[model samples]
Target: MKQLYYAALIYLVLGLAGGLGYREITKANGFTGDTQLAVVHTHLLVLGMLVFLVVLLLEKTFTLTDSRLFPWFFWVYNAGVVWTAAFLAINGTRTVAGEPTGAALAGMAGFGHILLTAGLVLFFVCLRSRLSTSDTAPTTTIGR
Candidate 1:
């Protein structure tokens, strides 16, 4: 889980660098338009960094009874995020390049977002069930 968290953080940093590089190159080329850098930044921070960290924390804090779901949730959510980020980056680049709009690309981005949302919801549900079933016993200290 720590490794996954670090990997997601690395991707977030890379996304930042990519956005900044795009801006610099565009500015140097004297190109200006609505490239949606804000969207890219938000997506990177939320989906890439925030979501992955949350998953890691959840894994560490809870002992899931049904461990079978963990791998499914992890893979689906990560894949969804990666797909979304990749498509958004491509779309942003194409928009900046003044290329013809592709419906398939837009659809891919939308599908990825949907996948991510679904994965997160499923993960939360699983976690909630496990936590509720666990016994919460009060702790006592002998010294006290």
Candidate 2:
């Protein structure tokens, strides 16, 4: 839970800072030709900050840290979000600068999506186990 809180806080700061940085970069460069760089802020906010915060809340509700797969999910999801956001920022800057993009960046972004999918699947599996009706009511309080 603490790890999740820390991750959420870190991503929140990064998302806010990245949004401001990207806005300034676009303004300074007069980059209105492409919307690629514009996506960096959205991804940082949604995937980095929002997702982690939601997960932290879920952890509190579900006591998700008890699951063995949770640590894997946490790390993998964060890695995917970070990897995707980094490439988005890089590609967005390159596009704004009128630079040509290569295949490597695309490949990395695809890999990030793969990691995100795998992590999500694992998270669902862990959630399913916890949601079984056989579990004690005291431990699995839904509205508490």
* Count of residue pairs whose backbone atoms collide, per candidate: 0, 0
Candidate 2 residue spans exceeding 4 A from truth: 133-144
lDDT of model 2 at position 49: 72
lDDT of 1 by residue, 1-144 (tens): 656678578768967876786777567656687664436666777777877777677667675425667666777777787778778778877777677658998999999988898878778777877676554645579999
Query: Which regions of candidate 1 are displaced past 4 Å?
Result: 64-66, 135-144
lDDT of 2 by residue, 2-97 (tens): 787778778878888778878888898887776556776677678777877887787777777778888888888888888888887887788777
TM-score winner: 2
The candidate scoring highest on lDDT is 2
Model 2: residue 102 alpha-carbon error in angstroms:
2.8
TM-score, every prediction: 0.79, 0.86
Q: What is the lDDT of candidate 2?
A: 0.78
Q: List all candidate RMSDs to the true structure.
A: 2.8, 3.3
Cα lDDT for residue 116, candidate 1: 90
